[model samples]
Target: MQALGPWLPDDPALPPVALAVSGGGDSLCLAWLARHWRKNLLAFVVDHGLRAESAQEARLTVQRLADMGVPARLLTLTTLTKGPGVAERARQARYAVLAQACREAGCLDLLLGHQADDQAETLQMRHQAGSGPEGLAGMAWMSALPDVRVVRPLLDVSRQALRNTLRGAGLAWVDDPSNQDMQAGRVRVRHSLREQDEREALWRAGLQAGAARMRRDDSRTMSFARQGTFRPEGWVCLGPVLPEPEDLSVLIRCVGGQIYPPAPAAVRRLQAAGQEATLAGVQLVRWRSGWVLVREAAAMDAYGPAYAGARWDGRFELFLPSSVSRESLQVGPAGFGLDRTVRGGWPARFCATLPALWRHGQRVGIPHLGWWAEEALQGAGFLFQPPVPATGGGVYGWPEARGAWFAAHHI
Candidate 1:
């Protein structure tokens, strides 16, 4: 674990840390180290309920951690409706449960044990899938989850070393039956990588290349952010020299207010779509001397107003005073034909796409537009945030401007 010193954040004021432990060799080693590193470590186990042994294994795992003096909790997930992508679905559910638990416990850091072998296996899998550099780069040492930061400290360490450590410490770990299922792509890839030593070099080179690429992109993205015009109306205008696909992905997520960027193929098409196109629910058009990104009017989300704090269109977070009742207000787009005189200089088309508060068949107000009708609501606040944090920096770079877009529009 001493090898982790260079990668750990220097801030000593970090909140209690959370680790996702599965009672497996990798995670168990992480749990042990985390217990010794931080007095306030919270261990979370997600029981996917996919197999008969899952429940008992979860209990035994937590019991062992508790015996080791680690605070632990088991989060049992309801069985998912049988799906084609059971593995992927289970993975998503697992992360969601862990992230929620971290939030509840006021932990910002979520640790995982993904060793060097896992990194090499990932690179192999992505390469076989015809992935780009971003995908082939494998996992980052640190990645931002919805609410928690995922720290993978074992990326440079070998899985065999971790297992040896556990065995030497007399720690027993549950061997998941699913890992041996050859039907899974990861299992197949893992077996192939085990026979090839060349992949280790590829893994190291891929990570280095990916990181160097990120550094170059970070500079480009920062310059774009400084020079571009990101309007409160959910539009961003940038120069004609388009950014790389990775940076374009970030821009699409931010401008479209989407939790995930569109697929790589879709991003490439959007980039080559000349002066106008729509992808990932975002419309891109040539405006003046540069490209502009805006939320596609027909694709935006709409929700009925809630009592106090309400999110509308997945773009605006609304906080109405207690005097306001949600039943009386309709929350949706202003749509075409909205009068713009009171909206100041906001573009008519853009203003029409804003989240409008409607009452008694009239538009009362919109976020960033100021309250128009006194009876509609007084002392109301609005915030513009996408479903996920916009990693304003490009691929593999620090999130230097992670929340800048939200901050600018949070009123």
Candidate 2:
């Protein structure tokens, strides 16, 4: 519990902390530990429905949590189907639903139960896939997602230790058969780590790599503060010289509104090209003194129904006053038919990618450029909130640095 100080804030008025309980021994133990740590907590059991017994397992997990005096909810993923890459698909779907649940529950932090064994397996898998240094770091204690932070308090603890904790408390857990499936890469890695020495070596390797990665991130953050200007218009202005490849990737990811950055090799190639190029739905164009990274206009999503809090293009969030009717309003790119005089010196390419408000095919608002059709539309606005920050958050005790960066940039 002392180690969780950096991850959780001590505030009573905040929403309850959340846990992702899979009914497995690792997660059940986590729930038990969390129950003792704080009473204001919520647990979520995700049912992928990949197997017939998944729903029942979820229900059982919820009941077990109730017995532990922990409030829980079951999230069912209905869109997932068994096919090629089913494991990856199920994992992605699970996290998506979990994040949505956290948002609806007003949770700022979502605890996961990935123990040391899982981290070792991840390290081995990434090593086999030729992952870079960042990937070799395995998992961070805390990862800041767009909507919430995913935390792993037991990353350094072994799976057997967690199971033992549950057993000591006279608790039982559901054992998923898929864990022993040899066809799965993670399962294979888990089995290979039967030797304590091998597991400890892998865990140590991850720790060393994570320490190095944190040092790199610190330098990267300083570099961003020195040479990059993040505009509230969802674009980034860089100095005359292109940033380091990693920093460049961060800019592209933020401007493109992507959850992950473009490949490091692709970023290196972009930097080598040096003049002007486009990658990962972002275009790097030469502006006045430095270069401007902007979203590709053609890659922008089409108009979708606009409500008071609709998020458009994954980059901008719409806000409308209660007085405005959402019947005919739509949110999409600020394309043609807009008055040119209201552009306010923003480039046409940049303007075209901005999230705009439309009603029945007529342009009504371009919040970034401060243009609205009428006085009634004045209250409508859009905030540039990308899926990932230019300086990604994963290190522990780094929120203060992130908050300071945002404050200095007026983001």
Candidate 3:
């Protein structure tokens, strides 16, 4: 429990916690700990449905938890499909299922049972992939998972100790056969670590190095950039001086609303262009003072008129409240095309992508810019709220690396 202290909420008045239990030794151990820690807890067994035995395994996991008086549910992943990178895709689908369940259940934090062996394997993989400090640091104890906080309280503990606890309690766990697959890099790495004399030392050094790397990452800040502006409308502009590689990757993701960063080669090309260019669905322009990045208007998908909840280019959330009949009203792009009369002073490229209200194919209003036709319909206005950052960390605005370093190195 002392090992779990650093990752838990400071408030002892605990909220109901959720755990992702896979019927495996590590996760089942977590189930036991969660039951001991909090009287109010929820456990989920994610059935990836990739194998014939998976469904039975989930049922058994639920029964075991029920025996312990801990209510558990089996969430099945139904959208799985056979394909290349099936394992990776299944992993993502599993997390998506878990995250959605947590949100619906109002559980802000979700616990996992990753331990020392998993940590070492992750670092080994990252090192082989030529990862930088951030990637080499391996997984953090706490990470932003869309809407839920993913907490790994057992990162510092060993897999052997967890299994020992289960053994002492007379608890049995399923051994997933995938763990022994020699073809998989992770399994191979795990086996190699077991035979290595320096395994313990390697794990310790990696954790210490990872901690140092995280401290450096947490200390990163926006202070170094000449100017940086992140708008509520999902556009950002950075200064004449380009951001560091790490910061630039995050910036691209934020403006593009993409989960993955632009390819390294693509980013390097953009940096060298120093002019108008587009990458990862984000447009980069050279403003007088510095550089500006915005979502590419041409790349946006068109939104036809709908009854309610109209979104523009997946960038803004739009809601139109009306008492009158909405059959005649339609929402579409504000065109700056030929013969179109658009109020000037704004970037023509950006204005074309703004949400426009129309009536019988006639332009009526440009909501975000506050433009309305002389005789516009009543009870009609534009209110758009961008979705909150799915993952909360030092990615956007100021980097937390500076703060992390200060806390670690200060007198």
- Give per-model TM-scores: 0.79, 0.89, 0.75
Superposed Cα deviation of residue 36, candidate 2 (Å)? 1.3
76-150 in candidate 2: lDDT tens per residue?
A: 989998888999888878887898899898998899998878887998998888777777888888777777888
Clashing pairs in 3: 217-401, 218-400, 218-401, 219-400, 219-401, 219-402, 220-399, 220-401, 220-402, 221-399
Error of 1 at 172 (Å): 2.0
**After best superposition, candidate 3 residue 364: deviation in angstroms?**
9.9
Error of 3 at 44 (Å): 1.9
Candidate 2 runs further than 4 Å off: 6-14, 336-339, 396-411
RMSD of each: 7.9, 6.7, 6.8
Tens digit of per-residue lDDT, candidate 3, span 1-411: 444343346343654578999999999989997777766788889999878999999999999999876788789988898667777888878877887788777777788898767877887776676665556556667666445777787765678778888888899999998788787778887877764334545555565666665455544443433357775545667878776666666677666655456666567767766768888888887767778777777776665764454555544545665653567777776777523244455577767666677778877767566666734344455443332231244222111332321111111
Tens-digit lDDT string for candidate 1 (250-333): 678877876556788878876766658888888777766777787888888764755454666766767788777666677778
Could you tell which candidate, 1 or 2, scores higher by TM-score? Answer: 2
Residue 410 deviation, candidate 1, in Å? 53
* Candidate lDDT values, in order: 0.71, 0.83, 0.67
**Order of quality (TM-score):** 2, 1, 3
Record all residue pairs in model 1 with backbone atoms less than 3 Å apart, i.e. clashing: none
